[model samples]
Target: MTEYWRVKVDPRMCVRTGLCAASAPQEFQLDERTGQGRATAEVLSASEEVLEVAESCPIEAISITDAESGKAVFPPDD
Candidate 1:
């Protein structure tokens, strides 16, 4: 099975815009204290559409990671 990750926003890049959460409400949430976005999900479950949320990040702060491989699928440079 394709494992999912509890995505984390890069602090340096995150701007507290809350766009990721808006894009994928089920998978992500904003931390008002830190003004950062975090994954509210456990396993992405393939049917998940969080990738759209990650892409919506203006700074690309959101990352879609493959838990088993420990490799990132988005923010290609990372």
Candidate 2:
């Protein structure tokens, strides 16, 4: 089975701009209760949509990670 990537959300930083959802609707969702719809635990699908969303999150909560290696697709905030 293909491993899915991991995503970490800084809830404090998450303002719920919904850019990640708009960018990668298929890969991300916005939970009304949680108020943040980051990809919590998904195998690295590596679709253009998924990576684009991970890269485009305005609040920077959604991160696409390599399932096995746990490497983030995007670099840490520098």
Candidate 3:
């Protein structure tokens, strides 16, 4: 079975950078009005590309969690 993850982009932390959308167009997009990165969907199929996009966020505005467990997947817990 394919794993799924919950994705989120913190608007407060986002600097209107298009990195997430550029890196993972299918999973992220910049809201035209807000000009902030947003997840295409709250939950998406797990993939390395998505994780890389989250990691590539300069401000670390993007976060991912295991949809089933609600465990942090990126920006790993300290």
Candidate 4:
């Protein structure tokens, strides 16, 4: 089975920097009109690049955690 993870994006904290989109287009996308980035998908498998982007978020709006264990994987700890 393909294990899945949970990803969250704080819409209010998003600054529309486009970094998340640039880093993980498959997971994050920026709205051209609003200029805010949102998760394209909520559930995903463990992706190193995606986790890196979450940690790199300037506003720390992005958080990734294990779907089953609900433990924080990025941004230090849950």
Lowest lDDT block of 10, candidate 1: 41-50
- My TM-score estimates for the predictions, one after another, are 0.75, 0.69, 0.94, 0.83
TM-score winner: 3
Which candidate wins on lDDT? 3
Candidate 3 vs. true structure, TM-score: 0.94
Model 4 clashing residue pairs (backbone): none
Question: What TM-score would you give candidate 2 relative to the actual structure?
Answer: 0.69
- The C-alpha lDDT values of all candidates are 0.72, 0.64, 0.91, 0.83
Candidate 4 residue lDDT tens string, 1-78: 236778888888988889999988998898778988887888877788887888899989988788888877766552
Colliding residue pairs in candidate 3: none
lDDT score of model 3?
Answer: 0.91
**Pairs of colliding residues, candidate 2:** 3-43, 4-42, 4-43, 4-44, 5-42, 5-43, 5-44
Name the candidate, 2 or 3, with the larger lDDT value: 3
Candidate 3 lDDT at 45 equals: 96
Ranked candidates, highest lDDT first: 3, 4, 1, 2
